[model samples]
Target: MKLARDTWLIFQRQFLLLIRNPIWIFVGVFQPVMYLLLFAPLLKPALNAPTQAEAYRIFVPGLLVLLAIFGGLFQGFGLIAELRAGVIERSRVTPVSRLALLLGRSLRDVVSLIAQAIIITLLALAFGLTVFIGDLLLAYLMLALIALMTSAVSYGIALRVKSEDALAPLMNTIAQPVLLLSGILLPLTFAPSWLRHVADWNPFSWAVDGTRALFAGDLGNDRVWQGLTIVAVLTAAAVWWAAREFARSVR
Candidate 1:
């Protein structure tokens, strides 16, 4: 009960902060829209084959996952900035539960990412894309999983890096390569043989594949189960790592 109460307080604080600075939310929505509108069309000609359409549909889920990942990853900036300003330290000295502090912040990102995913889905629909209700629900669940994984990943980075200024370059460097290697913009089929193998090993690819399966509506139960298993394992590992990092930071 204490943890729950503290988490609620943390949620309130985080939500208020978001309300005060709405630009972050706007940018989150805008970036994905731009990508879908600009990049999707530009690449449409090259990706027009039947296999490519299937691949492209599969890619949409990955893009949604990316939206959540980007939102959660960048949220670490808020934590780093607060720590630098001594705000986090001040909160730490209070009766606030440390776990609540971390969980609440992470939950905020998850919720925000869900909202962003909805926006992206709506935009895709506007573009004449069709997604079944069941498939959409599955995709949303995948987005939630991605957000949780990303939050944990970001928390680990935030705890280790110690400074917001030091985080920017590292975040960019890591995020770009992960997205590219995950086959977000290109299907693994078209990737060079070596790169195709690499994409198979990527956790992000599993997410994309799973989400694509959900959207495609004909995914086998076993394939869906496999994808879920992979994402669950990754999310669990990330959470464990973040917990250890958070403990170290508190000490």
Candidate 2:
């Protein structure tokens, strides 16, 4: 209960700060919307789906995953800023649980990612994308988990580096390969055999495949469970590492 209460208080403080500067919320969603409007039309021909709706069915899931990845990864920048401003330093003498410090910030990032995701989903619907409500909710659940996992990792990295100059290039270096390997813009079905084999080891690839399966209404697909399991395990590991980082930094 103490941990939960501390987490909630921190979350509320962070959330209120977000509400004060909400432009980021819209700015984050804007790029995905542009991709949906301008870029996705080109995929219809390449995908050769029977209709645009079918094309969107494939594209939207990948776009959401894209959003979750970049959004969560870049969140470390904020923590870096806070650290320099002595926010984390001030916490060293506090009674707050170290785990709560990580969870509160990560949950705030997840909420923002989910809000952006919902906006993208609604826009995709307007473009003829169709998905069942149950599956859609489950997909959101996956997005939240992805956000939590990535943000925790981001925070851990930020606390270690504590410099935006270092963090920016480092995050880009990490994100670029992860994005390419994950099959976000195009499915790996079109990839050569060797590339497909390489992608098999990428957890995000499993997530993209699983999310696509869910969007296609394939509830029984093995990718769905596999993705969930991989992501859940990684999330646990990330949270543990980030919490440890917080504990060390604050102590």
In model 1, which regions exceed 4 Å deviation? 49-56, 219-221
lDDT of 1 by residue, 1-251 (tens): 99899889988888888778878777888978887877776556677645434534755677887887787777778778787788776764678777777777877887788777888878777665677898788778777877888888887898789877778787888788789888776667777899978777777777777777778885575546676788888888887788777666665
Model 2: per-residue lDDT, tens digit, 1-251?
Answer: 99999999999999999999999999999999999999999998999889999999999999999999999999999998899899999998889999999999999999999999999999989999999998988888888999999999999999999999999999999999899999999999999999999999899999999999999999899999999999999999999999999999999
Every candidate's lDDT: 0.76, 0.94
Model 2 deviation from the true structure expressed as Cα RMSD, one decimal place: 0.6
Give RMSD to native, each candidate. 2.3, 0.6
What would the TM-score be for candidate 1 when compared with the true structure? 0.90
Candidate 1 clashes: the total is: 0
- Residue pairs whose backbone atoms clash in candidate 2: none
